[model samples]
Target chain A: MPTWSRRSPPGWSWPMAEKKMVDVFSDVERETAMTANPAGYAVTELGAEDERIVTLAADMSNTVAEFIAKFPERYIECGIAETNSVSLAAGLASAGLIPYIYSMSPFGMLKTCEQWRTDVDYNHLPVRLVGRLSGLAMGYFGTSHYAVEDIAIARTMNNTVVLSPGDAASCVSLMRSTASLEVPVYIRIAEAVSRVYDEAPDYEFGKWPRLRTGSDVTLIGHGMGLGLCAAAAEALYEHDSIEADVFDAAYLRPYDETALLASAAKTGHVLTVEEHSVAGGLGSLVAEAIARAGLSVRLGQVALPDKDLEVGVPADLYEYYGLTPSNVAAKARSLVRR
Target chain B: MPADITLERGRALTEAELLRRADWVRLQTIDLIAQAGLGHYSSTFSCAELVATLYYHALRLRPAEPNWPDRDRFLLGKGHVATGLWPVLADLGYYPHDWLKQFGKVGSPLNDHPNMKLAHGIDFSSGSLGHNLSVGAGMALAARLTGRDYRTFVLTGDGELQEGQVWEAAMAASHYKLGNLVAIIDANGFSGAGPTSQAMNIEPLAKRFEAFGWTVREIDGHHAPVLLRTFDELPDPASEEPVAIIARTRKGHGVEFMEKQPQAWHLGLLNAEQYADVVAEISARMELANG
Candidate 1:
């Protein structure tokens, strides 16, 4: 092994390779990067305001190092023990401190689901569980790391308030919004996302933020679901001249029935989209509401199949599952045309 | 915290008194299980002495002020033995002693496991194994960060050691140097399946704890005098190491039939005759204690 010190044994630096350094992206991709890593900002801001806001990550200091640096005494580096990190958060919550536990989606939500249920949700402890890289965000990591089923597993737990942010702004606002809720909360975050809002919108629990207005059809989504719905709305208006009301159904559990029903009544047709399995996710939540309320609106779901996932990039999985904006627009057009 | 078993002070409990309390816990455990016609028996009996020592001699708690900020916290890591602990809590004046008779009755707050909200004097509610330690570590950390002097104790099961969460907590407790936190694993050698060795060998637990940076202690779990002394001597809270007391014990401490039974009365009905026999056996054991 060759060892290099500050002296630089060989030509380690000053090697300038001339290349055309250009930022390549269409007008759309630029906007997507505007709101990346929202939860990190939200947690850092939350820590600044409240001294009781402590953070613990299971071997994820890199993602949360800035927040840890800001609150060194409060930050706990839990070192890959997802179960312990969550259980420790429960303990920290019990001791009158608000603990924000962060980790990769699968490990944070699914790996420690029992711990979350028994420790935090069971007592309604004021602990926040944030699952970063949710859905197919870990596209190449395969099924083990995918958190598409996070909504299904997290929402079904007793007294668990499951929140999934569609973009950077919603993710940040919703993180701040949950400060007062004295219940266990699960926040699923996605990295590769589009900035749906120009600025932070007024986010409320159990209420959908109505993004675009239309009377023909309703496009509902949460987490990555909202981003897809927003794009599909743009696609619908540009191509088919069909306008659909798009709502951010980010709060998956204790879902906003009033808003959903009212939107369904206005639109008379509903289309749901999400980067998750069609079963036990945003689509399922909307479908259950439509049936239970005896709504007459036509319902369609643009979501991944509940089967073995095909290996590919996040975009590949999304496109294959018909999770693209065009697929969502087409689905909404068919529902409204009916 | 900060105290190891080498020192002793306070109103020291005699071996006889500790034995008497153990008898009381055993007797009440039998009745609680008998009334429900189903409850953990041998598991509870195995830790009878340890729990009795903690409540009667070790923990610093005011029954009247269960939430006393300065008071020590006790979390039942092995919540299956919660039925055996109710009598101790009631006898300590935290709740009415009569609640024991309604162990598992309809609408009764008492369940098979402990619930902090439902049960008084329960600092952390735990049923599934390997959780109480982390919760206790939190309490210990709170005590230290908030400039309070208090200790947190968690009683875990030998079988519960198989859980990965316990080691995670063990590592955290040591990393934080939570000297105020103590973990007492009830190494009764049996779980629901069979012997712990058969299920998953968690032997060499003391060495594992040492490697995890904890002051480890081994003691006869059924002995009251030693437990009382050992708890008193736990290192000072300033020490940067948590404590692990591996209390060696049997699956069942009394009632030979129940002790000898496979699975050791994990859950079953004690018929009227069998119940009377167990009661008689406990009394006879208590008589031997007086001798």
Candidate 2:
């Protein structure tokens, strides 16, 4: 076998992502006919097989126009009432129809948190709540639109499944995964996370994707934080001679901890990364897993700080919050060093 | 006086017979609450006639087939009054008589509030206020979509109207023009702290609902015969307008002490002496009605 080389192959880093923090998805967006709105396409695809599927939104007809175009009679427009939309979805579910309640993240998941808990969760109904424009994706809209605490709020509901897909294809497939489940599902989706996956990977409920492998550190990322990990793996190998095992923790609730823990046995350190509050997010889940299993390995977490965020573009916000690939790699290096 | 059991509408019981049924429900409710040593009797007492009329006459229910797809749906928005409902279900044989004595006891499915998962007769679980009407709206919509003639009725406490979700549902019902849906506000005037007016004034209730595109009607809720007639004559769903029946009522009507002292009766336990007095009072009413 040939010996490994520590040096760069040919000027790859170029100061490592100093290009532009403004429009990050521009490159991948141009090459692909992908969209951030995957629920519409998934509804169309799922409705072809199951006509019992209904779509209800809080005046989000344009947002879920695809479902309307496919089956106009089944779509309901509730006009900016998230609570009514959720309760209505519960009602629809009670009548043996699979209803998907769609809206912006803050309103859909956070605003209607009680309805999700009491009506849908307590009753054990299968209502797919799609919170698009998650994270700080709608950067200029301020805290009203930001949904950093949704995953924490959603995952606490018993018998509920929470998912955060990193790309367009994963989003559609995750929507498909929610259709057949008997319990409620809350999908936290980002508006634009391009270039994370070239082709759609096979989807399975309650299972995460182990994208890359290494011996030093295992990086756990969820939602758009996942794409960051996938990108960081390449930079870490080339520039720092560090190989990290990356995992897309799409299923945040009912998460299968076997693969993650097994990877930890091989690699001694685990660092959870997420674009959510450090308090009750992927980091908290991983920490719980580590402590519950009585593992002696070190656990590091890189996540958004527990504070109000500044209003700017998401890329700039990511940089300010130390979510850039360089900062991610740096955090990984610290975990390995520890 | 004893309720008159003469048929009024082809095969329907007259107003007096309906009132006797209401009194019977109220008597059962007092005993159930006194037995558990915990219940919202006022909440239950106020809706007696409304419940009695619907179960005995108005609603289309196959008691043997409680889960029948075409059966009318009844959602109790004020679930603290679930004690009043349990007896009705038992009387109809929705559940066994054994479960009746186990209310509020540990290991029993019965609780302080309605739990549909634990109980078979309950249509929707509704401890949280202001949500059931929206759920009722949903059922009404399902009836529309499925081409089922089943009507959906939601009985809400006047206090529960304070919750914003009720108005949201009100707007939604009007927007869809779900004439198959009917909302009866158990406007018993007493709420959590005291009289609802002092707590949150929801006066001009009829005009407010009418403004929201519902055909509003005000009636004496205790007049079960009148309620049955009203239920029979209400606008059909084909009319493209929802109905809101404002059932004007007293919190605790049948019993003297409870009716006079409605403030604390929202939730109260009867001591041994108080329990005897309540039983005696209801017995006197039944004795007078028997004459």
Error of 1 at A22 (Å): 16
- Worst ten-residue run, lDDT, model 2 chain B? B1-10
Top candidate (DockQ) = 1
DockQ of each: 0.66, 0.59
Q: Give the lowest summed-lDDT range of ten residues in model 2 chain A.
A: A16-25
- Across B95-194, the per-residue lDDT of candidate 2 in tens digits comes to 8878979988988777778887788778888999989989898888887777888788899999999999999999999898799999989999988789
Per-residue lDDT of candidate 2, residues A27-117 (tens digit): 4463533354566778878988898788888977876787788788888888889998898888878777888888888898799999889
Return the clash pairs for model 2, or none: B1-B289, B2-B289
Model 2 regions lying over 4 Å from their true place: A1-34, B1-11
